[model samples]
Target: MAIRNPMYCGKIFIEKYKDEDCHLVKGLHEPLITETMYYEVQDILDGKKRKSKLTIMSPSMLPLRGFLNCNRCNRVLCGSASKGRGNYYYYYHCSSKCGYRKKAEEINKAFVDELKLYILNDESKEFFKTAIMDAYIDATKGETKDKTNWIVEITELGNRITKARELLLTGDLDGSDYKTIKTESEHRIAVLEAKLSEAPVVAVSPAEVERLLDKAIVKLTQIDVIYSNHDTYVQREVIGSMYPEKFTFENLQHRTANVDFLFQLIYQINSTLREKKRRASDRKTCLPIVAPEAGLEPATL
Candidate 1:
């Protein structure tokens, strides 16, 4: 539950010292967990994680309780399922004088309706997709070379480590000297191996990105289905990821500025061009559908 416990890092501090001097070096001891995992735990503990919005444990009901803020006073609205007659109802209640109140169903529907604005038309979808993939490919162009270099470095380090160990066993190297060299060599090998392992992110393929984007858009188009079909956990995850803060609902609509990136881009692009297209084909669904100009499609959204 706590990430601040440095005990997980495999080393203790030199007490009575300030700043980096207290924990300046690592001890020659085994680690319970990796530095990466330890930092991840720290991020969760520090509330600085990108996923901080969804850090709260999901409740059985009233998933939107902590996600909604009162529009009037800008305070978190508490929600609970209350039994009225033979069924239960959920509501978001204001904490202060605003006395703001809203039913969960209506609020959720409003949010979904707002999300629909971000779905791109077929043409715009193609434009935005190409742009996204092109950017990704450009970014990863150097990863292949980096991976190859890391592999070569790891091989060299491994051979050197083996030679050092041989020298130690043959009495050519003192025990202390062998230990220091081996530790440094092994650490370097580990670091390079890690780099090689992470060179090109496994999920950076264009097909995977497109598929995920399509799925997200499909859900936006069918928000009611998505919300009703999923469990409370999935529902909360979807909402939390879409909006990182407790958005206020005012006069019936959720005042959400933190819509999904793709959705926001689609909405902005379409707003700039007021033209609409007929539903030509199922394959050309969502986003603005416009004819290609000058043999080039406009890369929008």
Candidate 2:
């Protein structure tokens, strides 16, 4: 009986195996390749070494990532990973032909620092608070109940329910009929209750705005740390909330600062900062970039 290499007994068997009786060998010579290399070869053959087609998303980072746009091409910057010498690195890159790429850490730090500075200043901080309050109020503007309409509807539903109950009590209607009417009335009441529950309670008051602003300021001050380690999704959410516009970079030869909606806000907050920074000095100073002016109004919610 021919002794067989155990590794070759299964899928590795040769064409002649069917014609011969094979016996497993008790002892075999050392492997031709190191264990590590053998595994690597197997992985390659099995397509295990192939790059994954899955997208990576970090929920914590969504607050900051999606809002940034490419200064060169005006395209939304997207997160991507690349394999370097022996490790992978993540970066935000412009998807357009301009191909602007920056390390995610670098871009996030620079932007967050700028945001923090804007938020920390008294004038800008106040303006930011007002803007946020305005946004909240606008979001909840239509939630107030039309009392007359609701009263009428509720009364009709109540009467129907009462009639159904009376029919059941007096035996004027069969069990099935009573049940059907009662169920319909109960469903109507439930629907109205749900609508009331969903309605906005009230606009955030001025006092509440002050409290919220304080919290936002604290978070903004630590934005560098928050953004650096935050998940991609949270980073994106922060950015989207801010609604950054395309940054227009000028005087590239001298490394002029990129101009965008947020930059405009910074300028409004501190005009002197632009004067001292010659790079962005040429850009026209505009009014505080409002949500409406920037066309960043949320779609009708």
Candidate 3:
């Protein structure tokens, strides 16, 4: 019987021969793409693409994944793949029954490109930096005062422990009562100490802020490529970190998401670009801003 396709032959070989028995079938017929290429494609399908030697450690891979949402089923979008004709296509699909697929490479590249554009733009960079700093400041507000209160409470707890010990020694309190009070005081002190240690430090310096921004930008820049290399669990983690909501794609062209804050940021930037184009159009016409209802206002008065 004549074999029609090399893939069909490979499938037959896989089904008929075990790994150790593959050598027995080497001379059976001429192979397709060589055994090495076939195996390479299989490895890629199995999600084992080799990494480069120059790769450095990065923390941004999963940090922003949480924020992406499905635009169709409203469920969180998940990474998926399909193999056809010896090639694999990677993409994100809705968690529910709604069929929405965006090629992984395209979406990742688009996200990274947008992030790079944002980072390179002075106004966008400044806005992002300011937002991050404002969030940090807001989170730490009253922390110092809270720490001071805890310190006072810790001291009082220590004093209470000493008083309980004294009472037990003087036979005014029973042994069990003394132990209970001491344990409670120590637990309180321990909790206060932990909280005090966790309190945020003073305002970070501009140099430190810049360093943070640089790191964030680098991670954001590398997310697409890194995610393309990672496995499903890692991809899910990455997506979950960046966007906690779901991404939905309905009818392939129309997409909507509940990510208000992120959508707002993107919309604002897009609007700014559109406004620039509009201004250029207006300059070509040399038209001035028109006042509204100037002639009719006196009639109403």
Strongest candidate by TM-score: 1
**The 10-residue segment with the lowest total lDDT in model 3:** 55-64
Error of 2 at 54 (Å): 12
Sort order, TM-score high to low: 1, 3, 2
Evaluation by lDDT, superior candidate among 1 and 3: 1
lDDT by residue for model 1 (1-301), tens? 4456565777555665555445534767787887788788778667877644646554555767687778788888988678998999888788788788888878767766765665565556666666667776677767866777888888888898899889988999999988898899899988888777766565557678778777765665555566668887887877777775567765326344576665566666666554443334433776557754553665554
| lDDT scores in order | 0.70, 0.58, 0.59
RMSD of each: 16.5, 17.7, 16.2
**TM-score (all chains, Cα) for each model:** 0.46, 0.35, 0.37
List the candidate 1 regions with Cα displacement exceeding 4 Å: 1-61, 82-88, 96-98, 119-124, 141-224, 251-256, 269-301
| Model 3 accuracy (lDDT, Cα) | 0.59
Error of 3 at 179 (Å): 26
Candidate 3 segments exceeding 4 Å error: 1-122, 145-207, 218-241, 258-285, 288-301
lDDT of model 2, residue 184 = 84
Lowest-scoring 10 consecutive residues by lDDT in candidate 2? 246-255
lDDT of 2: 0.58
Model 3 clashes, total count: 32
